[model samples]
Target: MDDIAAHAALIAARRPRDARLRRVGVSRAGTPLWLLSLGRGARQALVVAGPHANEPVGGATVLRLAERVLADPRLTEGADATWNLLLCLDPDGLRRNEGWLTGPYTLGRYFRHFFRPGFREQPEWLPDGAAAAALPETRALLRLQDELKPFFQCSLHGVDVGGGFVELTRDLPGLDRRMAYAAARLGIPRELGPYDTLYWPRLGPAVYRIPPPRPRDLAAAITEAAVESTWYHPHRHGTVTAVVEAPMWGVAAVQDGSPPADRDAVLHAVSDALRHDTRVLKRLLARVRPHLGGTPDAARLLAPVDDYLLVCPGLADAWDPDTADPGRPLPALTAGHLTALGIAGRRIAVRTAGLLHQLVTGAGRDPSGALPELDGLIDAGCAAYRDDSGARWIPVARQAEYQARVVLAAFELAGRHGARARSGEPDWGTQAAVPMHRE
Candidate 1:
């Protein structure tokens, strides 16, 4: 957190006349949230970094992106867009994840220090009465969104282990293809399987359309709330919202589109593994419930576990052949896809155990009597995941570069489209001839 603050300060200081940095709001922990605004164009482009606390790659991406745009006037001038960059949306949660920020970048180390807020706690996905009820960080972002009403918005996010992918609220012509090509240039494989955004419609290779909200029940409503903010910007201002998902670790399997020899068996096995991990997490949570004090932080710590417990069952059920519709065949299940699923489940369990271990041993507590079970669970889970996934650590700089290119691509697409609309030109479905930035 200090490093990010210092970097932001340095960036602002470097270009004092043009770069404007100010405190937007205070986090739940009283940490100041900063927004750095640059450029002087008619259209506004908002780039939010580190919306998910666990995904710290965006921290580097935002800093580098700010520097790139500030140095290259053509980027801002040609795009005709003023860029508003938020360094980190969830500082309080991010502080919890700082242990692994400067790291060996191994899967075990990453999972050991991992800290992801529950869906409800995420700044991007606030409920209806967010102004009063949501985290101060979330409210700050909402205020920014309302104030900027940007024509282009990109939320920088990443996965622990998988091929890179991007999700767009609107299919902005050739932007998806361009972003995928950029990531590919960086040797980041396009995620071919349905890993994170399972039901979202595929717009192109490694590009997905963010699914629209369709809430029929409370659970569905909660899920919708988690993603509603992505649509909020677009629905109000026709903003082209792009979610850049870079992977921390690259799995060659995720790039392979071939179906497993026995697809149903693979799916069922993945489902069984997830179910088992869910059960383990539930048991661990139950054991730690007594130690958790009556505090908001404690609730925050427990929320992800509760969310996993709630959602994992349905997710596991969906993988069952008996439950899936026969008419709608399942997508190709690659070895990498199955590995990603297994790793995701183990990640949840390990993270839950990690947090629980912190609570039990934190605050000058005696280490000898602390919960050994929690430590064991975390260590075992991390080792199992590391050994099984066969995932390679992707450098932070590489991930940031890939994400920066994606953001730039979005900018070019939006600028071209806006220019066309202004001249009363028809919406020609031709691709934008934006120059790619090679490292």
Candidate 2:
């Protein structure tokens, strides 16, 4: 958000002269992909940002981290590892969001300028199938992975609002405590609801594991994994993938501890909401069917909203209610998570609905009333998003700092975990308070 190119240059200028910046690959749009490397230790780690264009907070965080490592060799000092940080992985998509990067960031402005890579298009997800590294940017990352074979890979991402949390492939001991403390120090609450736990195991209050996707043979990959895909997790087993989900808003709400709603009621609401979303999407698609001739990546554009209505809810339904109950009088933070989900759901709807409106209204700078049946729905959704008072835009630098702290802790934890792993120690996934660094 804070001029990624300039920041990259700044890192290059300020970094210890021994640190090296190398062009790893290029994005589809010809943006040069770069990695800043330092410390040639035995172990290796890869930190990436801009995997999702909409979540550039991670990119800023990664840049800040480069500064920290360069200034104090001790940050990565004792931990014997080589680090390669890829700044802004999806610059092509990020550029699409640059309009709002310098903003009086309001709810409306953020969504209007938003665009996240779909599952199939995401670099992290693509490596699983026939289309491995299909995107030029993805190929660059894959090359980096092949060359580095990192013991850890972290994707920096921030959520719209809820609370701060982390998703890991294999649970690392004591990392949860570190994350909770990081959130506290940042003055953010840890999300308590099972929004994510519906899919992954809750390690601690806010920390979760990436839920393994439904059986790979579940007829449809997109439909199945749409809800909870650990595609990035198992890509290189024994390697850990860590994600930091910081919130842009929903600060006080996260601390709420109210009793939740009934499980049945939540399921009903989810099914009904998604079914409605699907139906509206179908109608909009039909209306604009003729106009979609040769639109680039139209299918990919539609995959997310389609998956939202069909596969996503089915996965939620399959959750064991006795063990995982996500619906409730969600504490302020939990409720904020739900509110964020609803708003995100509608963003997809609006994206498609807007296109439909454009087509019907002649789809140009000066158009007529093309929004026939969808007008009220679009208007109502906008009002609902504005109603959530928990929304606050955390400055990019603040978020980056918060994220940077978590990562440093992760590096130490992972180093300890790796050292234990090499010694044939018990899985750290379930262990607690073991020595942080055994090597």
Candidate 3:
């Protein structure tokens, strides 16, 4: 959906006249915040896609869901929820992603076009204050949630590598079974321990349960506070907030079930990489900050790293694999997870360097002198990402279909009045039965 207006028009043509489209507010740059709505059922459900322009996997899934529901209004018959569809929630950032959206959806292409905001400035975690209220997109979402009080709120997001995983407010019954089936059918693996050591309530290989954020966690630092925007309001507790994380590139190593031989070693390696990236990026950023006034997308690029450099050390300090439910098997990762972990850190440095390069060129300066060592770092990181991403790419349409299936299943599972399924008792203390993937 690079040409959002064009896609929006196509969606409008498919849906009935009852479908509504309007600008809810304006983006920071004055781009209209648009929403499309269909169904007037008693229960309200809101689906958000492109919450982060860098993660575009859900863009097609959201559109397909809207199209299906439009063609057969009964698609949501049992759920009895009015669906508010918000696509490209951050068009200002998304437009910056157009360079890679139309191409081969490779990891490198994605990183090249990425423009994620800082955790605090992101749609989900924007600090609640006068400044936040002034953010038209943030305000519009808050207004809609307050007005509708949705029964379900799901934000669509994706990852750079690995497989698919779902995050829900509560551990619902039978959702795991459906999620596993959908991912297997699509030939994608699950991310065993995503970003944080969140492997818990092991419903299945890829399906996971995410608890509500605590006051302490939010207070610890902004990194801990980067809760989904849906959590900002009291109405959120009663609602089923789900996050679907699909990956751009995946491999067999992604789903390795075996535990690492040295958990401490693996944890330290990734944490060190993250911390190193933060320091390196911070130094480069200080040099580039004064010169950013001339770049086309300076703010978009600066926000992520500015926040990242400040909070990364805290995140690394808190890493603990022992806290995860050992009994529940992780979907994938072993040695490969270490590589991916390092790449995540490298991407941050690469992104900052690319932006600095842009700013320097715009200001008519030679990049080598202005941003010494940046080109080498970016080039080295990119070479590593390419080496890892090779032969691991999936078609965007296939990824969408699998995501839609999992989401639809979740809708049924989370419905208040809809048929509920069996809840499996999890064995929280035991070693994983499956072996890890080792080359």
Candidate 4:
């Protein structure tokens, strides 16, 4: 079969025994957008694919859930149990998502290579006023949701390295119980549980807003600035809907090249977490914000991005170093350095620094111990800068490169710890335990 046919077949094979496959639309790049539906098609459940590209995990998860739902004869037995699963909503974004989609399964390697935040360089970011009014993918989703009016409209997304957690629209209601249950079952950190901005109850899940898009009105000097705006979830059409974020750190398993069983063990643990809590999740979905046609003021929704920019060492004196400043630049920071900086800031950085310190001090630290931390620093730094690479205060891209260097050090530490751990002389202090410099 040709590539298109092959893709279709993969979706078909993965579909449950009674589901049907249909082409939803063509991607901007001309690739096909497909939809998988099961049951009687009443549109009671809807799972939308995210912007695709660098993060196909959301699409993959949707597909995986579809397969499992179809296979479970008990749950899918009802005629009224229908779902609309959009596969590859943004094929244009997905085409560029090669490495992570096809690469080896390691979070560290995935972190080093997968880069998509600076979407200006990306093709899919091109929907101008005309395209925005009717981008092929966007239009299709809009029309479908209008017609189906699904009970749950979940836009799937994967969070980056800095942190991982689940989110729900504050206006939509709480799935805290479901989320907490899943995290515990998956063995994900409890601290990673659901959270939200106390100020804007309407922004939905805090995780969905993670490394949120750079605010559009920031200083022009920053190259990697994010454009912050509330997205339109079709379910917001009084359909009782919102987005679902499954952070990568929460899903993908990593090790120092451990056996497949070990990796699968971790993946399944997460999968089970989501699966077991489905009933609780169903209960939570009954209360998303009722759609109000008018959109909210962007400015009111977004605190100005200027506050988050990271300043360079030169600006160090400018920013009262005594106050915890997200924008202050750290020329060459390691995980240890981040912890030290955090220690200096005291309480503000303690949460993140403690997590880093724990991983570094693990008895059998993975060979890529630094990988996650380095990813966190880069994420926090960029987030702090709101992606402004040109900010005079700091050169974010350069700082990012320097942050990568810290990741390399952590990698070496991980390798050393892994070697010793395998040999049964795991030393959590010297090899595994790297302390945060206090005072």
Best candidate according to lDDT: 1
User: For model 3, how big is the CA root-mean-square deviation?
Assistant: 5.8
Q: Estimate each model's TM-score.
A: 0.87, 0.80, 0.81, 0.48
Residue 205 C-alpha lDDT in model 1:
65
Tens digits of per-residue lDDT for model 4 on 1-439? 0233355467577654667777777766677777777666443556666564555555545555655556655434543457667766666555534544555644333433343322222222332321354466666666676677654455555443222233332122234344444444544322221212211112222222222233342232122212321233332443433344443432122101122333333333333322332222222212111221132322211111112112122122222223324563322222222222222221112222222322233323434334354446435543432232111121222222222222222223323443454598733322221212221
Q: List runs of model 1 lying over 4 Å from the truth.
A: 129-133, 216-226, 293-296, 325-336, 363-376, 420-439
lDDT of 1 by residue, 1-439 (tens): 7787789898889898768899999998899898888888778888988788998888899889989999898877766768899988888889988888878766666766677887777788745554454678877887787788888888988887777887776666787678767876888876765456555566666676775544344455443332456445444565767888888887666666555677778778878877887776677667667755643377666677677678777667776676765665555556556666666666656777776666665533533344677777777876665566657777778889998998888788877776776698764322322222211
Model 2 per-residue lDDT tens digits across residues 1-439: 3376667767677665646678898777777888888776767888988787777787778778877876776655556677788887888778767766778786555655555656566665543542444677766776677677788888888776556778776677688788778777777666655354433455666667765444453324543333333225334546777887777654465445453455456544544565576676676666565565555555545555454445544444443233233653222334434543444455556555544443444333222233555566566555565564344566766688888988888888877787888899887563432212100
Ordering by TM-score: 1, 3, 2, 4
Model 2: lowest-lDDT 10 consecutive positions: 430-439
- Who is ahead in lDDT, 2 or 3? 3
Q: Number of the top candidate by TM-score? A: 1
* Ranking 1 against 3 by TM-score, winner: 1
In model 3, what are the clashing residue pairs, if there are any? 124-229, 254-332, 255-332, 256-332, 258-435, 258-436
Query: What is the alpha-carbon lDDT of model 2 when measured against the actual structure?
Result: 0.63
Error of 3 at 89 (Å): 1.6
Lowest-sum lDDT 10-residue window in model 1? 430-439
Stretches of candidate 3 above 4 Å error?
A: 129-132, 197-203, 216-222, 225-228, 232-237, 290-300, 319-340, 367-372, 388-391, 416-439
